[model samples]
Target: MDKLTVPTMAELAAKGESPEILFWVGCAGSFDERAQKITRDICKILQHVGIKFAVLGTEESCTGDPAKRAGNEFLFQMQAMSNIQVLDGYNIKKIVTGCPHCFNTLRNEYPGLGGNYEVIHHSQLIQQLIDESKLKAEGGESFKGKKITFHDPCYLGRANNVYEAPRKALEILDADLVEMKRCKSNGLCCGAGGAQMFKEPEKGKKDINIERIDEALALNPNIVASSCPFCMTMLSDGVKNYNKEQEVKVLDIAEITARANGL
Candidate 1:
């Protein structure tokens, strides 16, 4: 693989260059070790398809999804305002986020606070790329006969109604795409929403992620695909709890697409 060239928005600004879109590397995508790989694959896809994109780098702050979800509206607004100021300074008009949490807040909540931009989730962006014929998935590793099931993140599905784009991205692989009994608008959360990931379950009969994984495992999928970083972590942990880590793999949509496209 060739070395990846990821430019920071600051670098682009210094050169009087503007990117087609800003890649918002959320908290997980930046700090989480596992999620960093997903971030890189997302970048590789953008680079492979010649999409001029740049990360905010040090200028970027937390989208405050967790803070907002945790009921700290004041902190959330403060973070949002700071981020908005930086984004406005750079004149960013379009943004794509690897995490659904960031995607939701940036697209929906920010507008009320004076930060407006055309925000798209990575899965949506991938579907767009496929539709444009820029990503053929022809020269990459074959998922031709594999069974893959996608776990919808709460923020991406029910909260925002972005259901089809991700499914469409996976459909191109000619793989067996199975749906859980509760999916789409009826999709179950991976137990990580509403800042739940930061706390332990409050004496629940069963863990939500475990139940979700049970639904996916029932399909006997070879791989469990997820679009959100929180879902990835929760689903992965659930898989481990079942001792099925070797039998089933958990991967992000961007990672799957990157591997399938050999990017």
Candidate 2:
């Protein structure tokens, strides 16, 4: 991976003269091309509706979630302090992050480390935009051709109580939506959260995500959509490993919305 370094929030504030919003694209979304595209699409939609936001780019470093979860308090404190200094410099009080891990860390954990900000997940912002009529899907061009299901990220759903925005977004697309036997607050981990993204999972009976893929496929859905980049990456790998290509797809909620809007 590239060296993990980020701008202090002050440096970012200096760059944007007067930024209207701080867009926090987490490590996964920043490193993964597909995730980046979805993030860009969301930014476009927000911009179309006059939401002035500044992309933090490489300046928004890891939220230290992996370190903290791994019990490496030293590394976690270093990362957290660096990020706090950056945020303090920028005078940023509000942040929008695409990754639920980042969202949870910033919103819930940061205050203890002297970083306080109002953090909102991308899904929440998208739902708001749609509700205000700033974002709309074209009517009738439903994913009538395929069936799909949504996977709830633990941080976004159980930890933060944000279970409906993403599902609502999918419902608008008119896709054949099915619920996983374990969903919403009861959703299973894709084996990618809680810093699982940075480490190898212990060998087990089966991969958590693969099990999820099987469940989604059991419903015969052509696509499995989710809000978290980590979940998307894991589930996509699960589908590929299972040799379910051509039979199913994995998509981010923003990508689904973009398609529904005919963008």
Measured by lDDT, the strongest candidate is 1
True-structure Cα RMSD, model 1? 0.8
Clash count list over all predictions: 0, 6
User: Positional deviation of 53 in candidate 1, in angstroms?
Assistant: 0.5
Q: Which stretch of 10 consecutive residues in model 2 shows the poorest summed lDDT? A: 1-10
Using all chains and alpha carbons, the TM-scores for the candidates as numbered come to 0.98, 0.90
Name the best candidate (by TM-score): 1
Residues 163-199 of candidate 2: C-alpha lDDT, one tens digit per residue: 9998878776766889989998889888888778877
lDDT of 1 by residue, 1-263 (tens): 46899999999999999999999999999999999999999999999999999999988889999999999999999999999999999999999999999999999999999999999999999999999998878778999989999888889999899999899889999999988888998899999999998999899789999999999999999999989999999999999999999999999999999999888
State in Å the error of residue 195, model 1. 0.5
Local error of candidate 1 at residue 238 (angstroms): 0.6
How many steric clashes does model 1 contain?
A: 0
RMSD of 2: 4.5
